[model samples]
Target: MSVRRTVTVSITPEQDALLCAFLASGRYRSISEVMRSALRLLERDEAATLTAMRRPVAHDEASRG
Candidate 1:
């Protein structure tokens, strides 16, 4: 089984409303599911950014020799 932990978060009324709307739309079963999906997207974007930053510049490589 996977390990799980509980976390506390604070959000503005507007944000809460958005989460409620998502639930009402039937796309997500719970607020936690919505938050988890959002976090996964964020993780993917950050990983892509880090991968891009680690790539060598083609022009710089040509100037070396």
Candidate 2:
């Protein structure tokens, strides 16, 4: 089991409309579900970005060895 916390966030009208669209599509059950999916994507993207940033350094060191 995990603990859950509620946080209030402000979104622009455009963002609100997008969220409503997702809800209408029935792909997500709630705003929380949509937010969780978005967060997961963000985390994956950040990790990929970090790996990309380190790739050039790794290649340079390999060539010098």
Q: Pick the candidate with the highest lDDT.
A: 1
Lowest-lDDT window of 10 residues in candidate 2?
A: 52-61
Candidate 1, residues 1-65, lDDT tens digits: the string is 68978899999999999999999999999999999999999999999999989999899999996
How far does residue 32 in candidate 2 sit from its true spot (Å)? 0.3
RMSD of 2: 2.8
Cα displacement (Å) at residue 44, model 1: 0.3
Model 2 lDDT at residue 1: 67
Clashes of each: 0, 0
lDDT of 2: 0.95
Can you list the residue pairs that collide in candidate 1? none
Q: Report the lDDT tens digits of candidate 2 across residue range 18-58.
A: 99999999999999999999999999999999998877787
